[model samples]
Target: MNKKYHDVFSRLDQKDKDLLREYSVKNTTGVIFDMLKIFEEHQEFKFIYEEDGKQVNLVEISEMLKAEPLSEYGWIARFSKHVKDHEII
Candidate 1:
């Protein structure tokens, strides 16, 4: 895992960590990946998975999103659409 990712992952709460793990397992990379990709395009991004420890940070994720140019309505619409499309499958 990249150092930056490790640092970010160290800050996740239990709930967010669980969600990330679940998403990884299901190969479902929608909203989270979208957020990450946005950050990655501007900055750097990485993923870290640890067997016996938490591997991501919700606060950092929040901060990254906050720093991005995602409009509130647009993000919600995109996320909603992605969920709706996924549910149809």
Candidate 2:
């Protein structure tokens, strides 16, 4: 992984860290599915199309979630809002 990416991952909160660890250990497909489940309810979470015509995937989303320059409390609040808006656990 890139150093910047690794740095981002290293700074994740406990819950996000746990999720990353779990997803890394499990099937990538399952991880993607779970991400979609979360994203579906969060309008702010959307696919970013690249010039190469590739759609953003779960790994990228996870990286973003981990790297967002917000306080732990802010991250949780946003995450909770997304969950509540989408009725996701």
Candidate 3:
């Protein structure tokens, strides 16, 4: 694990760990970078799962759709979409 992202991955649960394993256990934090580079363009996390020939997705809702501002919407959803979902980003 890279020290820079230790704080991020540290906060995730075991299931999320398993999800990251789909990326690779030796470099799980790569998914975060993928999310920033790819998913941000579409408002949700998605990447090619080449072995399975399908896109793996992360559940993320736009703060604008929620009733609260970013900080308070975190009170409701960080990753809350139901579409082709895997876990909260």
Per-model CA lDDT versus the true structure: 0.55, 0.56, 0.48
- The sequence of per-residue lDDT tens digits that candidate 3 reaches over residues 2-85 is 987999988889888877855562353444445345544665444333456655443243323222312323432455552335
**Candidate 2 lDDT tens digits, 1-89:** 79999999788987897687656635543554566556555767765646678677543566454334243453444654445333232
- Which sections of candidate 3 miss by over 4 Å? 25-89
What's the TM-score of each model vs. the native?
0.30, 0.27, 0.25
Number of residue pairs clashing in candidate 2, backbone atoms closer than 3 angstroms, sequence gap of 3 or more or interchain: 0
What lDDT does candidate 3 reach at residue 69? 19
The TM-score between candidate 2 and the true structure equals 0.27
- What is every candidate's alpha-carbon RMSD to the true fold? 17.0, 15.9, 13.5
Candidate order (TM-score): 1, 2, 3
lDDT of each residue in 1-89, candidate 1, tens digit only: 79999888789987787677767634543555566666556545554444667776433566455324345454444554444323322
**Where in model 2 is the C-alpha error above 4 Å?**
28-89
User: What's the best-to-worst order under lDDT?
Assistant: 2, 1, 3
The better candidate by lDDT, 1 or 3, is 1
Worst 10 residues of 1 by lDDT: 80-89
**Which whole-number lDDT from 0 to 100 does residue 48 have in model 1?**
45
